[model samples]
Target: MDFARLTGLIAATYTPLNERAQLKTDVVPAMVDHLIQQGLRGLYVCGSTGEGMSLSSADRKAVTESYVQAAAGRVPVIVQVGHNSLDEARELAAHAAQCGAEMISATCPSYFKVTSVDALVDSMQVIASGAPELPFYYYHIPALTGSAIDMPEFLQLAGKRIPNLVGIKYTAPTLFEFQMCQSVDGGRFDIVWGCDEMLLGAYATGAQAGIGSTYNVAPALYRNLVDAIEQQKWDEARRLQLVSIEMIRTIGRYPFHPAMRCVLGFQGFDVGDCLLPQPKLSEQQAEQLRSDLQSIGFFDWAL
Candidate 1:
């Protein structure tokens, strides 16, 4: 996809909220600015980290509009509107286009069996139909999608079948799918590494950029990592990678959303806590996280 040619520090942003868990739309602009100032190349708004599943349809649109408007064409903003509900996804895609997002993305429908390659292709086609002019990349996250698309099936229609189908945010640990994507028209399709911990490895495997959850915490460090890779400074990249390795692997297995909520709280944003089906980090753990961050010298001033 032709999405700003964005290739570094694409923050998977958080949707800030008030104490009521209502959409606190105002917090977005400042957050986006903060990341930009910290050296972010792009913003991946309304994604898994943004707690899209925790938002209402209209709220999602508002959040996307708020960020896109705040960005004001300064940088690329990718709106992840992927949801099981086609109606919601379409609404979000249209909202993103109206607000001037560079690209739109969606996860395949899940929670029920959506078997067959035809189903995946058809669903993606429907998503692409929402904003035909802008490119749409399929979000490959089988664990969250509750469905899987074999590599052959995914590569077959990434471009030939769907004209605007540009690239993919391949999220799982399996590099095999990404390798297949590289094999099948690497020029047309931009493959982004979605796993945070394996970013350095993915970068070596032709993952031009990465969309990740932890960028909000330390964007500069990631920017440094990317730069180090470009400069062939493997040691620097490994050091920063070590700093963020914990959360990338363990977030999904634990009460991560709430932990991120706590981190944001410490960062001075009133993003509040995670809703039901997501657990909050323990007060002790949260405090220790802050302490550990201080020890690592991350966000000392709490912007």
Candidate 2:
């Protein structure tokens, strides 16, 4: 399918929330400014990092609107409109198109678990049909969705069926399958990598773009890694990727989304905490994360 080639850092952004855990639309402009200043190429809103699944449909639309407006065409915005309810997902995809989002993506419905690759392709085709003009991406994060359909096979099968099937947000760590997906159709699809910690490995496997939750706060580090790869500075790339791995490891010690919010607060923006299902970190826990990050030189590396 014809689509813009997405490259470099695409941050899977977190939703800014208020004290009452409401959608804090006011903070979006500042968030946009911060990301732009940090050298992010695009924003993937209402995705896993943004707590998309935890939000109501109206709230997700509001968040998407806030980001798209704040961006004001400075950078591309890929809105993740996936939901267990295909109707809701279609509504979201249509809303994203109306708001002028650059692209749309969706994960498989795990509630009923897509039984086969054909079924998966059928669901994606239906969702993509919502915004036929925009490029459609299948969010293949099987680890979270538990939809273990073979992605390379899915790409080969879905490529013919879904006319707008542009690519996938490849989050699984299975490098072999990832490579296979990239080789399909002479690598015509935009296979954006999703694992932040293994970004260097993804690069070696020919990933030109990546989207991740950690990129929300530590974009510079990833950008530097990308630059290093471009310059053929393998050692420097390895070192930079190691630093990112260490940073992700540090945040992994706490509840991921909450710890990420805490990190953002340390960097000067308070996006608030993760909502229900993902518990919020206590003040002490936040402080500890700060201390831990400081000890590991996270501030120096990421900032």
Top-TM-score structure, candidate number: 2
Candidate 1 lDDT tens digits, 1-303: 344455776888888777677888888888888888887778888788888877888888888888888888887888988777887788788888887998888887776656877788888887878888887878888788667768556767656667778778888898877767866754556777888888888888878789887877756667777888899999888977876685444433446777777776777666777766666677787877666666655664223
* Prediction 1 global C-alpha lDDT: 0.77
Where model 2 places Cα greater than 4 Å from the true spot, the runs are none
Per-model TM-score, in order, reads 0.91, 0.98
- 96 Cα displacement, candidate 2 (Å): 0.4
Candidate 2 residue lDDT tens string, 1-303: 677889889889989998899988898899898888889999999999998999999999999999999999999999999999998999999999999999999998978889799999999988999999999989998878989899889999999999989999999999888888999999888899999999999999899899988887888888889999999999999999999888999999998888999888888888898898789899898889999999998888785
Alpha-carbon local distance difference test for all models = 0.77, 0.91
- Model 1's number of clashes is 1
For every candidate, C-alpha RMSD to the true structure in Å: 2.4, 0.9
